[model samples]
Target: MSDKQESIKQAAIALFAKRGFDGTTVPLVAEEASVGAGTIYRYFENKEVLLNVIMQGEMLRLEQSFKENFPYDRSIREQFSHLFIGLIRFSQENFESIMLINSHTTSRHLSDQTKCDYTSLLTFLSTIVEAGREQEVIDRDLPIEAIVAITFGAVVELAKCFNGGELTLTEDLLETLDEKLWRAIST
Candidate 1:
């Protein structure tokens, strides 16, 4: 993509992350991007299309963060640590992306393809939880979806707090939070 297009995506991600899709306007995105509103139209047919593109791209990036150097041969505990740390690091680096992703997940503007993309990310996490359950390392009484939701919900809330300046994020804090989260799910 050209510089202007990339700028538009970045601006839209920030605005959508902060104001939400319905609260944000195309003119606001153009202003943030330092481009004409018509330029965004040139790239995306409409706001919904823009949101879909951004959501899909952000989902792929998040999934990639989880998959990078994943410990396929490690114990479930170690795998869980890897996933937790990966998410923390990703949120630290892409705060706006995470906020946008978490907030707009259920937006009415999302396309079917965007929904499918989000589901694939969840499926990846569920696969890990399933392995843990088979090994008797995860709580079997709780469903996979519940486990994921609980863990992810905690992390997302923590990220929101950090984003809001309510908490100071550090390596030690991240490790502690990771252990706490792991214990919450591990058997």
Candidate 2:
């Protein structure tokens, strides 16, 4: 992508994260990106197109963060730790991206491909939960979807707290949160 396109993407993600899809407009994105409205149109056909592209890119980035240096040979508990830490790291580094993703994954403006991409990210986490359940490490009473939802809900709320200035996300705090989330889902 050119510098202009990247700037548009970054601006749109931040605006969408803060104001949401319906609240945001193409002209607004162009203003935030320091470009003309026509420039945004030159790159993205419409606001929906831009939103879908941003969602797909952000989802792919998140999935890659979990996959990077993932410990396949480790015990399920260790694997969970790795994934949890990966999420924390990604959220901290790309707060706007995470905010946009969490808020807009179910937007009516999302394309089918964007929905599929989001589902694939969930499937990756489900695979981990399924493995843990099979190994008798995670709670078997809960469905895979519930387990993933619980974990994500906890972490996402924690991220919100941190972003809202309600809590300081120190290393010690993160470790405690990770352990607490693990115990919540584990047997």
Candidate 3:
């Protein structure tokens, strides 16, 4: 993408994160990006298209961050710790993308392919939970999806709290959260 295109995407993400998809407008994004309204059309065919593009890009970024930080050969506890910390770090570094992604999960404009891509990240996390079950580290009675939901749901809420200034993302707090999350699922 060109610099202008990237700028437009960034501006759109900030606007969408703040105003929501339905509330945001192309002219607002263009104004924020310091580009002409027609320039946005050159890059994105329409507002929905722009939102989808931002969502897909952010999803890919999140997926890549998890894959890069995941400790494939480590113990379940260690892997979970890495994953949780990586999530917090990703949220801190890409607050706009995180908010944009959190906002767009239910959007009607997102393509089926984009939804599948997003689902794959959940599946990847589920595999980690499955590993815990296989190793007898996590509760074997609970379904894998439930385990994943509980674990991921907790972390996501914490991230949201941190993003909203309700909680601080201190290192000590992250470690405490990691331990608490592990204890929640572990046998």
Tens digits of per-residue lDDT for model 1, 62-155: 9999899999999999988998888877887899998899899999999999999999999999999999999999999999999988877887
- Each candidate's TM vs. the true structure? 0.96, 0.97, 0.91
| Candidate 3 lDDT, 90-163, residue by residue in tens | 88888878778877887888888788888987888888888889989989988987887686567667778988
Candidate 1 regions with alpha-carbon error over 4 angstroms: none
User: How does each model score on lDDT?
Assistant: 0.92, 0.91, 0.86
| TM-score (C-alpha) between model 1 and the true structure | 0.96
Off by over 4 Å in 3: none
The superposed Cα distance between candidate 2 and the true structure at residue 144, in angstroms, equals 1.1
Candidate with the larger TM-score of 2 and 3 = 2
lDDT of 2 by residue, 6-101 (tens): 999999999999999999998899999999999999999999999999999999999999999999999999889988988887888888888899
RMSD of 2: 1.0
- Name the lDDT value of residue 138 in candidate 1: 95
